[model samples]
Target: MNTDMTRNDFRTVAREALLAAVQGLVLAIVVLPCGLAFVVLTLVSLAFVPLGIGLLTTPAVLTGVRALADTRRKLAAQWCGIHVPAVYQPLPRGGSPWTRTFVLLRDPQVRRDLLWLPVDMTAGFVTALLPALVVFYPLQGIMLAAGLWRAYVPATGESTWYLFVPVSGQGTAFLAAVLGVAILAVGWRRTPRLLAAHFRLTRAVLGGDAELAERVRVLTETRRDAVDTSAAELRRIERDLHDGAQARLV
Candidate 1:
């Protein structure tokens, strides 16, 4: 891949990923209240434990699912470098809440995203763990090793140590520490690229020909609307001239 293109794509994907993370965090936060409410409702139901809990948790779960789906949609757009329509298809006229909910549940995009969110979340969590481990574990091990070396290395060893004494064990430990730090630096540097690649893969798998066709259709309609608007304005101007100035002269 072109490095510049990849960098640009990473920026876009990173923005969307951060937004998705925020959305997930928000949904997770919102679930607390909903969970409490569910608990209360379940207590009141007093029977059919599974069904009661399911009914009570449904709203929050559905909200979370939708938020995740939206995140995926945005990520898909960023990854594909295409603008996904933000506007949802309007509900059918006089549709009831149940009908709308059912329609959403049946939406291909929503189902795809619902299926993907857990995996995405897992990927994100794993990615995050890499830096933490690469940084913290190495630092911790180095500190422990250094302390052990310092305490245990014979202070009066080798005739009170030469001016440029090179302790083999200490040198090996220092090299290992340096290597760990290098690994961490490299991992941190590569994280954004990894994330972007994952996002691209996700977009490829979840984005279909139908979605692309819909986007093209939307763009076509938008251009047509713009042309019609310009023509309408010209007609209005002509009508105004004919009615006002031309008619007054006649």
Candidate 2:
């Protein structure tokens, strides 16, 4: 029974580790292209400023970025179990494209999103790649153990290996496999926390304090509206009493 439970535990950990690795790979593939596109769009918009086409391009870029940020927030909620609440100020109605763009630009949340982009690109890339590396290292060790290195390096005096660790023969391969298993063991435990940390950072930069402020602002406005509404209702009741009920009594 103990052995069975141990096997099940190992299987569960392995499954989770692989899932995290796949999630990281997906994140990397999506984030890299999106980041590149956003950078390119921003540059194009700037370059087109003198040509006056920037007005069109700039707003489009901002809209795209906002959409992308929203998507990331949702992804964080789904994958990391934490919702980075939206803190974007509502855009004013009945404005020209340029006016609306300026409003978006002025928003603190918008600025935060912009600030998060480069960092996301860098840190996300690393986080996304690391899992796959850990997962695949064992396979590389297996290949080296099987002596397939001879086919690849027919005349090599030396060969460069990943992680700068040698996996030359059965002994080294065994070591490499052990190292890889250790990494896998540690990574499964850490991957969820790592993803959570990234989402927390996203929330911090994109909405943390700003979200609180927005909530406060909303509550204040609601309170004011409620007070005004009560005052108006009291006056209407007094007027009704004076014009109808009191007048009828008189």
Candidate 3:
């Protein structure tokens, strides 16, 4: 029974790690490129705002930026249970495009979103990619040990590398495999924490102390609600036992 429970625990950990890896890859590949592209578009549009051509276009582009930031906030909450409330200053209704564009430019949340884009594509990109790489890179060395090194060697008859171990022959291949397995064993348990770090990194940029307080406030409210719900449930169950069972006995 103990052995089965241990295996189940490890299985759950492994599954969470794999999901984190995939999430990291998604942030690295799709989110990174889309964010950078949006930034470029926004900058280009801003450059033309003086010409009256970008008055409308800039706000449209900014809408995309807002959407992207909101998506990040949603992911942060869903993936890592971090609550980053959207605190944007609402746009005044019926303003001219010129007025609205500048108003968005002046808003603190909008400014942070713009600032975060560059950071996200760079530091955020690497942080998001590292968990997946750490989990998968060891597999290459293991594959090399399984006779993939011969395929790795070129026609020039040169040796290939696997984690600093040169795979010149079977002996080196075995060494590489040992190193790979060691790494995998060590890092597998930490994969979920690594992805959690990625979300926290973005949260640092997207929301700071205010967001932390908000998250805490939300958690307290949720806990209170849960306690209240449990109390109500207990009372209902007691009433059922009293009215149904005691009435029959009486």
Looking at model 3, residue 23 earns an lDDT score of: 89
Leading candidate by lDDT: 3
TM-score of each: 0.44, 0.79, 0.81
Candidate 1 residues lying further than 4 Å off, grouped into runs, are 1-60, 69-88, 131-137, 148-175, 201-210, 216-250
Root-mean-square deviation (CA) per prediction: 14.3, 4.6, 15.4
Superposed Cα deviation of residue 92, candidate 3 (Å): 1.1
Model 1: per-residue Cα lDDT over 96-129, one tens digit each: 5455555655666555545445544555445334
Q: Which residue window of length 10 is worst by lDDT in model 2?
A: 153-162
Each model's C-alpha lDDT? 0.51, 0.73, 0.85
Ranking by TM-score: 3, 2, 1
Question: Residue 173 CA error for candidate 3 (Å)?
Answer: 2.2
What TM-score would candidate 1 get against the native?
0.44
lDDT tens digits, residues 1-250, model 3?
Answer: 9999999998998998888888888889977779879989999999999999889999899889989988988898898897766567679899999999999998777887888899889888988888898788888888888998889888787889886888888789889989888988898888778878877877788775555555766898899999999999999999998999989998
